[model samples]
Target: MAKKCLGVREDTGDPCKRPAGSRSDFCFAHRPQEGNEKILNLQHDPYHCPDDGQKLWYVPRLKLHRCGMCDGVLLNEKEIDPLVLESVLGLSKVAEEGLAVECPTCSTDSDLSDGKFALSNFAMEWGFAVQKSKYHSVYYCGVSNVGHCKVCGSTWFAGPGERDALGKNVGKERGFWRVQPGGSKIWGPLDMQQRLREERLRLVARKTEKRERMREKLCQHVDSNGERCNRRKTQKEGSEYCFKHRPK
Candidate 1:
């Protein structure tokens, strides 16, 4: 007697009555091969996807639980834990202060004062798929925050610090030398040019001083024109000219 295929449609849970393969319990349509059954279940899983109420699939090796219809990624148990802990422990309070920071993109300060709460919460979900079967499991994930810069409409992820989503330091004022004396203040363009000019003048003065010292050490030997030798004095004991210009 020919054997009936032991296969079921993951989406409708209907039995597949096609004849079994020569050496397999399942028909070619419901075979457990990697690309065949796996890819097929992704579009016809038994459980409905929470995102769109369509079929769902779980990939054990890859730890991926996704909706077949909408292709929405569902978080795993390990990934859901942090969100649950934060929500239950009221960690959203830390994100409230994040709105006080200045937007790094536009430099405009973000303020949540006018009933625009920055510490918003969202619902999430986790899903699990059976490795070789069409069964799926979904769990209520937790809450998350959708961060955005209020000033420029730029997206951001808030951290539990005094900095904004753009990583710019918060609550700090920017200006020119409200900067205390001796503190590291960046020089402005004109101020930098003035500094460069002063440095150049100082270097020129030092060079002029060096040249005067060299002139002061000139040889005292008289030349044929009755003029003192302009050569530097480098002789020992009693000589007056440099070694090459000395009276020889």
Candidate 2:
């Protein structure tokens, strides 16, 4: 009997029924290319990072695609719960309104146009035991933004350290806070709502700051007629012109 392929299908989350290739656990179509052990050959086309044009590598073990350049992570809807559980033990959290971005999967599909990834704020609670008293600490997972594709149910973590920040308080006690006997009070639903509101305001402020910075970096190149291009710069560093107007 021929050995079965070890590769998993991304679409249906089922094992590939194809026969394994000689000297490999996966079939030829599912075999990971040489020099890229972490990248898998999934059923769907490869995804690219929206923040950076870098190709997203499919990590079979993790069931997600990660951007090598930006450290961003993309996950399917089914994978979200498992990740949350692994990172923060699925603790009660809050999410704010979504921020829109171009969807990686839908962008490549010819049938889809203007598909968007709506990023949202995911705040998880971390409980700390200090002097035998429990205190709650809220951690936001969207320091850099966690986007979700409304069209495909995919989640994107635009990362330099977003994923790490999500799991920062996992599995460990960090600091101690002195609390009076009656000072340890449990937060009610209203308190959580207040915290969420505050977080939304902070996020809005941060977004505004980012927009201002980007506006400052707008292309400074003038055309032959001396009209300013007024477009965003291609690179964050170096040239001041957009890709089309940049000098060779």
Candidate 3:
């Protein structure tokens, strides 16, 4: 007699009723994919992925829990370095101000606005020229793509592609320096861009206000022939007449 499949249904958490495949404990429908057999025999309770609501599979080889559907990775602070090289991007500090996702391990909500965490894109660059080498690091202020949980130090990368995307350099040209009366400061590209945009709008508002004042001060002098003098007032002393219509 064929042995019963030793697989549990994800939705019902019940053993699979199908017969086991040849030389395998699971049937074709319950067969583990390549490199993911360990997930079938979970020693502990599985955690649900916060991003896709899928079952989080624990991979013993990598010592991390990963979502098979969305390909999102979840790991504690200690397990981060060995598996993810991008831990140097400062996941703890770069999570932007907002609630990203809940922690799969502890179910704690990861909110960056609680004043303990900061947000932005953590970037790095390195190159080699013959026998010489150079490395640089910078931060992009408005990019808050990665989700981080401060409670358990679990960082969530939406997918493997997002992890690779964080490795690229956000060029320095996009940043700008701001000089103030007290001192000077360097601002990230996105932050500086927003500031410059607001300044331009302020200048435009001032010009518009001046034009409206001039329009209101248009000379009200009427000639004896019944034609109104519509010339603009240029006097700073509050004279209501233009040079051409001023009283002699």
Candidate 4:
């Protein structure tokens, strides 16, 4: 394991986790209070420190800067752009509001806007049997919506029925499905479909093998001076004799 600073941070009230100095037992900041000043120098190359060869962590256009190793300024000539900084930091209200919707089951928040996967409302309509009343139900599935929660392993789906905008069902069979928490599903639709098909094929193969094994142990009785009887006429399990030949 790499060595870590044994000193505690004064500002955060936490242990200082920075690497300890090579020559000293403590980190640069925690070295004996005497002559503990930081050394800042120019880099021989752009965006990198010459003394330590560590890349500087800084946004040239936003004036947000930090040194990776030596705590020194590598580049400071670029002008600051507030708009660019805002875009980089994603400070807009739109971005904040997009993550407002939280999963009902897991209470985990998700971003709706700029979301690669999202839950969409789907409605199916049907006519009442004896009347002209229009009926419809809304459904949300994991395959359709990216609403599967990683924290609680919950899949939120609304069944067909009267529901509010919040996806609460208020009508007949009107409710949501809270799937039991289990392993996460990371497979794509095609992969899941292929897996299901493979499982079905395996089950069929097992059944076929069981039937063949049953046929192999059937009654082997032969008639008077004749050929073997091919019928599996035994009534009891694992019995080699047919019902007619077995002892009463």
Candidate 5:
């Protein structure tokens, strides 16, 4: 076993003046102060002194403006880019609001990323439905009853749907589907399974259209209170639909 020595400065060609031996080559008179202890009086080197003058061996950088001298050891100057220095030293920065936020779910803040991964993290947390709604989901199941995959420019029946269920279960009657990376969830060549998803979309679209029309007409009754209290009631919150913001 190699015995751990006390504090010893590495052997350099400089002759030993104050000989101090610890773990390193310096003799007893020249060891650095104990751990974390401040050396009130530091030896300086005449080479770089009034800094490194006492007797401590430290190199001073005359080219770079930094002195790595410790306990009165000397430092040297080395040319470095100011921009690079500021960046590495946590000195340069942009305004606070300009930064993109990290995913609170993942406890990671990335200034470099444009939040695509963050949104993915959010979707993973809330539910897949949110992602389906936020972006168009393509469902491509080959159930002949609903018709065939219509996505052009590609060979496979791609899956794209507005909802997760529509994409996943579209041609389920024929066989199960597997979601692929190219913005599609694929369906099998079942007879009636594919059409089921299409039907659902159609029904939803129709329902939405009807609701929108109703709200458009109902919004005309809005009052000065920023609410359509009702066709008659003037008190805010007294009506089912506000004139400007009608409920579906």
Candidate 6:
């Protein structure tokens, strides 16, 4: 069921240790596998978060950067824009293009390590929640909240439709929840910028196409003569032509 332990050593029959992993004995600890599960277990696990205590058992739904001391999570999905998180981290205010940043809390690079941490897999463990949502950044929001830390935004709408036990639905989507970097738990999943962007693009394209059609119709009404045009301003102009198209 658990699949052969994968640790059996043919030479000694005692779980062998791989040169790269300190957890080959039983996988109780591991390094960032480079291409696999981010097992948050070792005394110095790299994926250890330092924000809230969500490691070894909890991982942020989405993160862009992390703390190497307490295992805090940051969101940095490609879906998110950069200036967003930068603004939250006090790195920038113009959310036009995302830039490489450094956490005001830590010195980790904000690009590849933007949404991950590696410092809580040592001794302590805590239960918590994560919003897993993002705006311009995988770490914070851009349109809804004022900042990124969750110490002041932890509430709930109960279900997907914002319903509580009383059977009353608010019909609004509340944010997600998670602990702040150094404070109490909070509510988030603040924004879905990628989805927002896609929606915006679709709307613009549709409007542009409609505008092009209107221009074509107006131009066709002129025919070859630029004078008064072929079409008349009569109520039946839809069927009439401009002055050039009139019964020449």
Q: Which candidate's lDDT is highest?
A: 2
Against the true structure, candidate 5 reaches a TM-score of 0.19
Instruction: Give the number of the best model, judged by TM-score.
Output: 2
User: TM-scores across all candidates?
Assistant: 0.22, 0.37, 0.35, 0.19, 0.19, 0.21
Point out the higher-scoring one by TM-score: 2 or 5: 2
lDDT at 95, model 3: 38
Please say which candidate is ahead in lDDT: 1 or 6: 1
Q: Give the distance in Å from residue 51's predicted Cα in candidate 4 to where it truly belongs.
A: 74
Q: For candidate 6, lDDT tens digit of each residue in 5-87? A: 22323221222254433433243332223323322222234322332333222232332233323223444234133443332
In candidate 1 the C-alpha lDDT for residue 202 amounts to: 58
Clashes of 1: 1
lDDT of 6: 0.30
Candidate ordering by TM-score (highest first): 2, 3, 1, 6, 5, 4
Model 4 Cα lDDT, one tens digit per residue, 1-248 = 45675554332213457887887646888674223221111122223332244443433222323333333221121322333222212311222334333333222133342333322222211111112256753332211112232343322222223432223333432212111111123212333434543554555566678878977766677779886666676767667777776657
| TM-score quality measure for candidate 4 | 0.19
Q: Name the candidate, 2 or 3, with the larger lDDT value.
A: 2
Shift in Å, residue 122, candidate 2: 6.3
lDDT of each: 0.40, 0.52, 0.49, 0.35, 0.28, 0.30
Residue range 114-216, candidate 5, lDDT tens digits: 4443211000000112124756654332211111111111011112222232234432222121111111223212222234445555655766788677665
> Which residue runs does candidate 1 get wrong by more than 4 Å?
1-45, 78-248
- lDDT, candidate 5, at 163: 28
Please list the Cα RMSD from the true structure of every candidate, rounded to 1 decimal place: 25.9, 15.9, 16.4, 23.9, 25.5, 19.4
| Tens-digit lDDT track of model 1 for 1-248 | 77876565554334566888888767887776334554455444443332244444444433334443333333323523343334323322333553343222232133334534232322111111113345753111111232333334432222122332223332322211112111222222333334533554555566678878887688877778898777778758766678778767
Please tell me which model should have the higher TM-score, number 1 or number 5: 1
